[model samples]
Target: MKLLIIAPEQIPVPPRAGGSVENVIHQITSRLPEGHRVTIVSLRRGYLPRKSVSGPVTNLRVPGGSKKRYLANALRRVKGLAFDLIQIDNRPGFAAAVRNAFPHTPIAVFMHSMTFASPPMTTRRKANADFRHADLIVGNSLSLQRSLMSRFPAHRSKIAYVHLGVDTAQFRPSGKRRRGGYRFLFAGRMIPRKGVPTLLRAFKIARKSVPSIRLSVAGGTGKAAYRAFLRRTARRLNVPVRFKGNLPRKRMPAFYRSGDCFVCPSQEHEAFGLVNVEAMASGLPVIASRNGGIPEIVKDGRNGFLVTRYGKPAAFAARMAELARSPELHRRLSEQARSDAERYFGWQLTAAKLMELYAERLKTASAGRRTK
Candidate 1:
């Protein structure tokens, strides 16, 4: 198949930034069949208005002035190239644009997550428009699909769940185990939604009960005030928190290896907790809030623990304490977590599933054209 992928911006096959969406696009494009031709149409630069990506990509840089230029680019491709499918991984704005560009061409929109819960009016409108126009809609988790259904009931049949896969080879656990108590790790951006502050509070509570326990907080937005607040909170609470700001993706294995457990304290609707899966892949048992699709991956108390209520630092702390005291339980959960990730979240299996969906959609499109 000649696949044309229109991303929000130019990202390398294995993305270093842009969060999980970048990771998903990288995985699919990198693992696509060799015979297939893959072309990426994206913004020249994320912030600047450029013409093309420098790397090895078939770049059609938006001319200038408006996102409408993106529509013009898609129209040019539809008329100029013989593409089998177009996969869009961004907002509905792109989807509506593509539909206008190639009305007959089969377009599939990949929904990495939903924004309805906290969506702006424009976003919601575009999401609904994409639902009406796209031939197929792929959701990263059941939670995303359910949220879509509640908002756009008419497009219920169009939504399909495709769980995101993790790279076990890269994210697999390190064998080195440090002596003394468990070292807890928090990776991800230091944003409010991520609940970094909540994690700090929980860590403070946990430190009171377990003094030997160590904490590492990774990632940052360079929010100076926010960073200062966190540091001051740690000092006031007397918590031994190491604010090791932003580690590179390649070095993540080392960070994961250094920790005994991984915690994601996100308080909002997380479409899919990719971090949870990555932690499980690394053989570190996960402890995350039961919000969003986290429960879908973790079998609470089996592979990891799940905190239900939001803002419950005491409950979060207590769970950490339980895992810390129970060595046998920790061992069992860690082994099981790795096994589960290997069995279900491997890239090969994920690629195969994606191919199956692509093939099915292609066949349907072909049949519909013949019938008409």
Candidate 2:
């Protein structure tokens, strides 16, 4: 099967920068079986070639001054190209444009979150129309799938889910740090909804019980004022936190290994926490909010603890303090985290399942044609 994957216009495919959607695209395309050819259509960024080929995959980059321009450029280049299936990443408009170009081909709109499917991004009428046109709708988590199904009950049968994954081999466990303090790591944008302030407040409280406990924050961009506010909040609370500004994808494995535990204190409904999977792959226990699809990944007292009251600092502090004080619990959770990542959350599994889905869709399409 020859597949064309249209990545979100915001980021490049071989995400030299950092983007979860782009990373997912690159990982899945790279791992697909050699017998099945793949073509990636992505926005040009940095020094990536306009067109290139590697193994069974082809890279096609387009000028992306704007989302509109990106779509125009993408559609123009692939207008006459034949593909078994087209996968549009996180954009309803792209899926619509692709459908206009190739009406008969099977199209799948992959939803990484509810950000694009709801009000403010696209309305119920427009989103419903887009879903109706597509052959399949994919969400990265069951929570996201259910949410979409609820919104567009007419398209419930088309909405399916597959969990995102981490590269376990690359993000292996590191030797335990002998530093006196137990460190917790946070990797993501330091935005309000991300709950960086909440984590800082929680760290401050956790430190009172375990004085040596520490926090290291990695990843931040586009919100300089918010970043400054986070620093001020940490200082005013008398908390000592290390802030590592937006590190590239290659450095993330080491960043994950540096911490004794990973904390994702998101105050919002996270569709799925990919960073938590990366941390678990690195053998660190995860302590995340019990909202959204997080409960699907981190089981309480099994692989890690979940903060039931995520918005409150005390809730997160309790979990952080629990792990900091108990070495046996930490060790057990760490082992289980690594085991779960290897056994369940790997890019290979995600890629295989995606390929199977595409193959099945193509087979069904071929049968329909034969009957016609």
Candidate 3:
């Protein structure tokens, strides 16, 4: 089957910068069943050709502009291309427009987040209309699926959830064990939602018990003020912290291996924390807040502990200290974490599930047409 995927305008297909949605799209397209043709439409830098082939996927680049304009221009450009199915990644407006432009094709709107949670009334209305018309809607996690259902109960029949997958080959465990002092790692955008300040306080408290405990914070800095606040808090509390600037996706495995434990203290409801899977794949015990889809992946006390009492530095600190002190516990969790990742979260599994869904949709569409 020929597939055309419309990605968000911010990121390209084979994501150079870190984009979870783009990365997933790339993985699904690259791993699709043999003989299936795939084309991706996304934004491009200045003056590049409008269309080109990148590796096995055909990329159509729309000039950077307003979301509405990008969608309009892209629809006009792809009017001539034929496809059996159209997959839209995360843009409600784009999904609505594409449904109108190609009414007969099977369209699936893949939801990556709770995008309509806090938007204005007008935007919410538009999103509702878009979602209502889509033939299928898939969320990355059950948490996100529930949120969507709560907002649009009428669409629940069409909504389903699929867990995002990680590249196990790139994130497999190193045979080396944790040496020297205990190390903790936090990777993601340094934003308020990420709970960096809370992480700092927790790390400082953990250091009181384990003086040799150190933290390595890595990811893009979202806000300069928040970055400054984190630094000041670390210094004021005398926590030994190292700020590793945003590392590329290729270098993430080394970053995960360099630490003994992984912590994600996100205060916001994450759709799915891809980093959690990557760290698990790297064989590091993870400690994350029990919010959103995090619980679906972390499996509290099995692979790692999930801190339910969020925003409490003491609770987070206790978990960190426990992992640092118990090498036996750490070893057990590490082995289980790697096992879980390999068994459940590989890109191949994700692609195979998607292929099955696509084939089912195509078959159903064919049957409906024959009945008519």
Candidate 4:
């Protein structure tokens, strides 16, 4: 079957960025059946074209067309193209534009994140309406699925849940090694919603008790003032937290390997905990919040301990301190974390499941056409 994939912008086919959406796209394309023609319509030039990461397929770069020129580009290709299905990776008006381009083709949308709900109420309604147009909708996590269903109940039957998978092969269990100090790692954007402040406070409390502890934060400071506030808070609280600002993706595995444990203290708005998954894959126990899709990934006390949503510096600190002291608990959780990641979050499993969903959607679309 010929497939047309519409994306907001060019994403590397096994994406070097290590983002969940990019991983999903890479996995799906790689696992598609043989003899299937897959033409990727990416908006920008960051990704290379004609590179085969997966199967025998052709990836076409769209060269970043404007809304004004969308119809022109689509019209030019629509005449000669024999696309059996159209699949979109994001919203942001890209899917709507593709729908306009190929009105009759069956289009399935992959909702990587809840972009509509994240925005203000005024714009959210409009975004929700646009999403309702897709024939099939895929959510990366159950939390995301619930959020989407709450807004648009009519399409609940059409929605499917396909959790994001990690590269377990790259991130696997290597027996616990003693690192320099009781190292604590946090990797993600240094933003408010990520609950960096909560992690900071907990680290501060932990450091007061465990004097030899060290905290390393990696990721771009998304909000400048928030970044400053965190630094100031660390100074005032007397916490030894080192901000390793924005390390490259290639360096992440080494960073995770070096750290003793990983913490993702997001207050809320975390649809799925990709950072935690990476840490788990790297054979480290996670100290994550019990909110959003975090609980889905982490089995509290089994794989890792899940702290309450709100900040309790003493409690959070105590947990960290305990982990520091009890190498056995750390080792157990680390083993379990890696085991869970391998059992549930493999790219091969992700690719196979996605193909199943696509096949089911195609079958449904074919049946509907026959009935008409």
Candidate 5:
């Protein structure tokens, strides 16, 4: 089968600069079965060429500017090619444009979240039309799928989920024992909704008992005000929280390795926590909020601890302190964390699931043609 995959315009493919969606697209396209040929379309960035070929896979980097211009450039570049299926990453609007170009081709809109399917991003009528127009709606999590299904019940049959993954081989553990207590690591955008302040509060509470415990945050992708707010909160709490800024994808494995335990303190519902999977793969147990699809990834007292009191700093502090205090418990959880990622969250498994869905779509389409 020949496939055309569209990465979001935000980042180029082979996403060295850093974009999870771009990373997911790169992983999927690179891991397609030998029989399949794939072409990945992404925004032209850095020194990368407009087009480059590597065996069965082709990469097309289109120009960036406005979202409208990006889509136009991408669609224009692929006008001559015919594909068995076209998958658009995270943008429902792109499906319509591609549909206009290849009206008969089966189009899959791979939504990472309900961002595009809801208002403020796009109008409700537009969202509904976009959902109806796509041949398949692929979500990254069951929670996201459920939300989409409820929002567009009429089109529920087309919506499905295939969990995103990490390259366990690359994200493998350092195999080093924790020698200097637990260092809680947070690696996401520095935003209000991410609950960084709650983490700060929690860290302070934990540090009160475990004097040698540490917290290192590895994200700077937010407004200056928000970053300042986090600094002020940390100063007021009088805890020395290390802000490592945003590291590129290549450096992330090392970033994960640097910490003893990983913390994801999201106040809002996450569609899926890829960072948690990354941390788990790196053999660091996760301590994330028990909301959204997090519960699906993190099993309480299994891979890591889940804070049921998601907003309350005291609850998060209790779990952090418990893990810091108990080396035996952390050891058990760490081993299981890596094992779970290898078994369930590997990119190979993720690619295979997506391929299965695509193959099924082609099989049904072929059968329909035969009947016609």
Candidate 6:
């Protein structure tokens, strides 16, 4: 089968910078079945060739001035190419444009978030049209699927859920935990929706019980004001915190290995917490909020604990303290976390499931054409 993937304009495929969508595209394409051919279309800055082949995937770079213009140019460039399926990654506008341009081709729009599920009139109309045109709408988690269904009940039959997977081989356990202190790590944007403030307050409270406990945060400093606010909150609480800004993707394994436990205190309805899986694959116990698809990934008392209430610092703190105080429990969760990641979440399984979906959709389309 021939596959064409439309990636976000902000980042490149096999992302040098941080982009979950691009990373996922890379993961799926790299692990595709042996007989398949894949091509990726993305926006690149400055003057670069319009088309080129990178490794096994053909990359077509469009100008990055405007998303609408880029999509228009991308469609023009791939006008004559033949592809069995067109898979778009989390861009409703692009999906709509591609569906219009290639009416005969089967298009799959993969939704990573509920950004378009709820809206203020105009957005809903566009999102509805995008979903209505696509042959299938793939959600990365069941939480996202349910949200999409609630917002657009008419399209529930077209919606499907597929869990995101991580690279277990690269994020595997290092067989070493920090001595003398329990280190808790958080890796993501430093923003309110991520529940950074809640994590900070929880850390402060946990420190009261376990003084040796430490917290490290690593991610792109989203807003300058948010970074300042986080720093001030950390000092005001007198909790020992380390802020490592924008760690590279290559260094993430070491970052995960350096910690005793992983914490994802997300207040927003996260579609799927990829970091939680990465940390679990690193053989670290995870403590995350029971929001969105997090519950699907982090099973409470199995891999780690989940705070049921959102923004409850006290509950989060209690979980932190429990893991810090009990070494046997921590070890048990750590082992289970890695085992779970290996058993269920891997790129190979993700690719296989996707291929099965693609094949099914193509077969049904062919049958419809025969009947027509």
* Residue 282 displacement in candidate 4 (angstroms): 1.0
Q: Tens digits of per-residue lDDT for model 1 on 304-353? A: 99999757888789989888888999999999999999998877777677
Q: In candidate 5, what are the lDDT values of residues 1-372, reduced to their tens digit?
A: 889998888888987755878888888777777788998989998789888998888999999898889999988888888999999989897777788898899999999877777778898788888766688899999999898898888888899999989898899999776567579999988878789999999999898899899989988664888888888888888998888877887888999998999999999989998999999999999999998888889999999999888899999999999999998998999999999999998887888889899999889888989999
Instruction: Kindly give the stretch of ten consecutive residues in candidate 6 with the minimal lDDT sum.
Output: 115-124
Tens-digit per-residue lDDT, 89-194, candidate 4: 7553555666776788878888777764346522756666766668888888898889878877877888787887777766655555665798999999777778
Q: What local distance difference test score does each model get?
A: 0.76, 0.89, 0.86, 0.74, 0.88, 0.87
Estimate the TM-score of every prediction: 0.89, 0.97, 0.94, 0.89, 0.97, 0.96
Candidate 3 residue runs with Cα over 4 Å from true position: 46-56, 116-122
In TM-score terms, candidate 2 sits at 0.97
Cα deviation at 97, candidate 3, in Å, is 1.5
Clashing residue pairs in candidate 2 (N, C-alpha, C atoms within 3 angstroms):
none
Candidate 2 regions off by >4 Å? none
| lDDT score of residue 26 within candidate 5 | 84
C-alpha root-mean-square deviation, candidate 4 = 2.9
Q: Evaluated with lDDT, which candidate comes out highest? A: 2
How large is the C-alpha RMSD of every model relative to the true structure?
A: 3.3, 1.2, 1.9, 2.9, 1.2, 1.7
Comparing 3 with 5 on lDDT, the higher-scoring candidate is: 5
lDDT of 3 by residue, 104-189 (tens): 88898888887643375246666778786688888888899898888888788878888888888889888886687999999998
TM-score winner between 2 and 4, please give it.
Answer: 2
lDDT of 1: 0.76
Candidate 2 local lDDT, 1-372, one digit each (tens): 889999888888888857889999988888887689988989886678889898999999998888889999998988889998999989976777788889989999999988898879989899998887788898989999898899999999878898889899899898655565899999997678888989999999999899999899998769688888888998899998999989989999999888899999988889999999999999999999998889888988999999898989999999999999999999999999999999888898999888888788778778989999
